[model samples]
Target chain A: MIEFRMPSLGADMEAGTLREWKVKPGDTVERGDIIADVETMKGIIEIEVFDAGVVEQLLVKEDEKVPVGTVMALIRPAGETAAPKPAERHVYETFKSIVNVKEEIPPVPAPAHEGLRASPLARRIAAENHLDLTTVQGSGEGGAITREDVEKAIAERDIRLKPRPAEPAPTPAASTENIRMAVAAAMSKSNREIPHYYLETSIDMSKALAWLAGANRQRPVAKRLLPVVLLIKATAKALREFPDLNAVWENGLQRKAEINIGFVISLRTGGLIVPAIRNADKKSPDDLMETLTDLIPRARALKLRSSELSESTITLTSLGDDGADAVFGVIYPPQVAIVGFGGIREQPVAENGLIGVRPVLRATLAGDHRATDGLTGSRFLAALQQLLQQPETL
Target chain B: MTEADIKTTIFQLLKRIAPDTEPSTLGPTDNIRDTLGIDSFDALQFIIALNEKLGIEIPEQDYGKTGTLEQLIAYIKTKER
Candidate 1:
């Protein structure tokens, strides 16, 4: 078995946004055939197969951004198990640690005769109810034990399965909520606590618009100039010079490094998610556009894997014409800064000592004051200003 | 120390680290904010301070659950065990 990893797009790139999967799992492929399209820091790159046989499994799906060395797909010569052998990377557990208890509990050993392969949680539910899992057949995918199986077992019998009268329903024992619920709690806490200082700067967008218009005229309509792509390009340039802005404030420690960027997208059903653009500070405008557009939808669906959500140094939030010129964004905690991109509007502004109407857009940077001072903020904004001014370079 | 002793130690630790916070209102069941009001940023600071004071590491991954005092106590006990 061979593994295909997310190749670094450029020299400075530590990761690439998994933009789109051109091929699905179990697809046959040849060497040099385009397997997936990855949006690298440089541009949207075609992930061509080096050795061809069968794409046994896609370790990553389209729109999931991953680190450079992360295995995105695995290929087998003919037939091989996609399941990463447990020996290679079982959840390494210390005997006891605070972090361990909260993580996914280990899967319990299965009962051989029962033939009811149950996850740890399902087995616990069954044991708690005194329902014989052996009598109940699994209806889940691939004969896996599901909550429904236990429920069915309970229903098929006429016996009352309630716990002893003295136990008192475990009193909603542990008061444990899912991790998603924890995220909600964090959001509410952020809104209530963070004294978010919003600095909105409307940049002259005439150059970007003109440059994009001309660039689009040269390229296909399917790939046109979008503001986000341009913003990525411009922000990348700004972050390159002011890397301090790209930081995380962890337990009295400010982790200042890579200029990864996270952008928000609202889901079709409900709620919002922020999927990050890995190493945006290095990606070209076209590449940034490709990464942002693809990953935003995946993020909204909560389909982004753990890899995608992890390791972002900074983030961006945009309301996209939902409100006025500026959006005061909440800093995605741990991250030092979040930039908000508001809708572009035509406004009169002074450019090169000349007052004129130009397409301008509001860009706000909310930074952790402890990490990035106003001067560093000024440098980032100034660098951004300098980048936007050079539409010719983009 | 027993799990209950560790919980009490944590409750005491919280007060020392977050000087502005008075956790006398805190209980095993009470939410962190309901007991002693803490916003998200404040919560982050509190976690950092708690870890530093205890000389225990609370990785960023665990901070989500450890935000509340009740949860934090549970987390520390799990670690001590």
Candidate 2:
């Protein structure tokens, strides 16, 4: 039997509420199959299972909030005839819970005759919000209370207590503010702990844009590539050479082999999310453009998968089109470096003989000083510049 | 498609790209991107959606010709023939 647990979606996620289950007992599941939708601070993310088996039991019910690493289910390996019975499974779960104190055991419901029949989730939320269970109306089978019942009670109570007019049911602004707060907490933690060193360089983008324009002239709008794709590929290729900068700082530097670049996509509402384009170095510019185009809309809608949010080795931020001349970013925690690209601008440049106007891009690197120094950052920038100058090679 | 049909379809596609914007508020001759506050990515998305909805390929050079609602309708009408 294998245990399926809640995954840590990012450094910011502490716990996630099991919004819905896509699998049930006796259903066969393969690796990478989405098993549940989990609602975290980041939003509802489709959680993928990493084990191939028949699901034996679901320990947590829908709407139950559980911490990271809390086992939500057990999977019986394929071709197993005799799965654990309910009695044996109960003993096993009891033993496991004894060993893992953080795993919250559901409160045993009272006998139906006495009072207050509610699911464990309803009870927990009521206790947390200081709501009286006696006042809540049950909406489940046999009038058993569920999480939705308690939530409705809370909303009604809020409406009653407040003197203002009726507020909308779904508060997009409130959720946006929650995202902003989460971002603030992560960035503050990054600022507090990471010892950051900054580096910047200006690269002339005349050759790159010329190549892109000539190349795009033949392709349709849907298939044409963006300059950001070239930047991402160049950054990933540069990281292949400068291994020190493409690492995460745990207790020490943990260098990653795959170049997963977390490209930051800002939402129109307010905050931003960085989702990884996995194995960016291995992908051609066309593939990079396709992946980026697919990710941007999903990222804006807060519909990213858990792996895409969690697996980035390095972060890349580009101020596209309308932003300032340069961007010195803060290094995200665990990530040792962040690469930033400023908007491409037309400026006077001294070429071989005379000064002329050329499109210039200012690229910045924020590196964790504990993992790498300024020299390593400088070389990485140089490599990025060299790669961009020959866009056909990328 | 007639001009009215093309205009409605274009507004619907723009609504998909920028879900928060009110497409009916846009004027006929106003710049679609700047008035809607959509960036280059969104502009590209709008173009792709137009192709999917109208079954027409918009070239890079013709992007300037389709800058407003009236112009986009006219461009799509010409292509519809």
lDDT per residue for candidate 1 within A1-394, as digits (tens), equals 4556666422244555666787887788776677776654223555666555676667665565566555566566444445433211112121110110011223222335534477766777765544446556888888887887777776654232222222111111111122233345445545554445557677888888787777865754334445567777678667777766776555553655667777666442334556668877677777876775567545533456545665567777665533368887777666667888887788888868999988888888887776767777767877787788787775
In model 2 chain A, which range of ten residues has the least summed lDDT? A94-103
**Residue-by-residue lDDT tens digits, candidate 2, A1-394:** 5556676543455666778999999899887787888675666667776556798878767776777655577777666668433211121221112100011223333223356688888877876654556567799998888999999998875553343332233266766765785677568767878899999999999999999988888887688877888999999998999998888887799999999998988777888888999999999999998898889988877777867887889999998866789999998777899999999999999878999999999999999999999999999999999999999999
- In model 1, pairs of residues that clash are A41-A283, A98-B79
DockQ (C-alpha) of model 2? 0.31
Worst 10 residues of 1 chain B by lDDT: B37-46
| DockQ (CA atoms), all models | 0.01, 0.31
- Per-residue lDDT tens digits of candidate 1, residues B1-81? 676775666667656534446676676667775356443323434555555556566654465676566677778877766
Cα lDDT listed for each candidate:
0.59, 0.78
Best candidate according to TM-score: 2
Query: Candidate 1: where are CA atoms >4 Å away?
Result: A1-183, A191-195, A321-323, A351-354, B1-81
